[model samples]
Target: MKKSIIIAAIINCMAISSFAQEFGKHFADSTLRLDYIFGGKVSSDGKPECQVLLDGLVRTTGWSGRRNNLVSMPLAGNGRVTVRDKESGDTIYVTTFSTLFQEWLAMPESREVARSFENSFLVPMPRRLVTIDVELYDSNRKKVVEMSHNVNPSDILIVDRSNVNPNPHRYIHRSTHPERAIDVAILSEGYSVAEMDSFYKAAEIAVDAILSHEPFRSRADEFNFVAVGAPSSDSGVSVPRLGAWKSTAAGSNFSTFYSDRYLTTRNVKRVHDCLINVPYEHIIILANTTEYGGGGIYNFYTLTTAGHASFRPVVVHEFGHSFGGLA
Candidate 1:
């Protein structure tokens, strides 16, 4: 037993070392943002046809994602992003996700009209040229559509957003270095500049609520929480059913897809743009509303009401979907 245990330990250490070397050889310490448009419609044969298109590529400062899991995935999500070495055709990096577009396609609206949704993903900036493949899957876990393209690290056309000013933010819970921890950014959606302090307090409560649960409770030190104070001209989110609209930070709204309780934002690119100044792999937007509604999409984001009576539990539950990858 001791010999076997020793061998396992040695192998694990070697694998870690190998991944670290691979990361250094292939990637820089920056982030490469892949912007995509996911769209779908019914085909001539009455079959659902889905497609993915590369909207843009952005370069930003710092990479806070996992460097060890360079090619392995913990979850086989609804969609995938694969980055490969153009020269050797070897997969250097990969990530998976679930999208709002995938959910919208299941609804009746997709059949009635073709529509598209914005999605953006961040990968460690590559040091050399690479080919990227974006894919979407259906309910049966079959690939519906895929788009491929090459990216040159030295491309002059890639948008350089590294110098953009980030929203005001503060750390609610400080953990290990960003490279070794899960960084969660809690963004203020509808809070005005005067209400930022209240948002900070709510973010603190959110941190405590999340860490109070198991897995997170036992591994609390592996997480870091930052409260982003993105103020609004008017407080509270939009309620289209009541004709109540306000100028919120991320343009979040209730009644998504005509479902009153489904709260979400279509401005995914804007969300990523806001986090350029912070270290975030997962996002949790705290809208300053008393409405009892929230939404979460895997590898996307978590948005919930901060002033509702069930704030604590709702934030925890939504974080499970965003961070824990819970169904």
Candidate 2:
């Protein structure tokens, strides 16, 4: 979870590439769009999130509930801006405030660089999806486009072709039944599989208990599992100063390993492409070591070497992220 130090620090919000287009160009066309549902303005009564967010815009944009002449009003907590055609009910696109805005928000210390227009994602919304249908008009109050979803804030993962403006948008894929795959690579740093049985059982029980919850019921099919080897030399090894993570006496070095793992894990999408043996979406690495240390990521997975079976459960639990994106 403490994988990418940079991603962990950034402020969370959503917006697309540009101001004038449909949402089809951002991701694979086979996907659908789901927006963040802003609370209060919309209800979660099984309603799509995009509607809640867009509906809020119509209500607040100084339009006074009027669809035409929809003036652009940057909401107090607004992170993204949207524009729609009054007649056609289409959304133009999404963009970010200059890098200065990110810095100004952080003040004395901000890590974001000022991005230029060229680096922005600007495109059109897609052909089909949920339709809250709030259209925007031009200066003449002519209906230009309309948007189907303006959502509430609860984050979910789903493909959105509604806005092709891509700057790395997030999506939530909810499923009524959960499915997952796990690959555990068992390596022995200094111990054997038999010695780590206790830890293995502990990990398995923990994973089983964790999956007992209901939230993941809808989206678990993407799960996967795999395993590899960990030689004795790596049993209690700790990575110190090599990356953003630090080593601790009580598994501190393991933290550094995670940062480095993240450096690679972050690019896991490519890993699958390179290794014909690997799956593109998710994977679980189980090291058969004794010392305590392991971690899991949203799209990647890992576990330290435990006993003969100590890491089996660890691999399953961590796979939740690489396969389910639940974390």
User: Which segments of candidate 2 are over 4 A away from where they belong?
Assistant: 1-253, 257-275, 303-327
* Cα TM-score of candidate 2: 0.28
lDDT of 1 by residue, 40-138 (tens): 786656567988888999998888777787887666688899999999999999988999898888777877899989999989999999999998887
Report the C-alpha lDDT of model 2 over 103-198, residue by residue, as the tens digit: 122222112222111111111232333123433232243333334543321223333222332211111222222222222222222323343443
Specify the poorest-scoring 10-residue window by lDDT in model 1: 10-19
* CA shift of 23, model 1, Å: 0.7
Indicate the worst ten consecutive residues by lDDT in candidate 2. 57-66
Cα distance off (Å), candidate 1, residue 210: 0.4
How many pairs of residues collide in each model? 0, 98
Q: Residue 113 CA error for candidate 2 (Å)?
A: 16
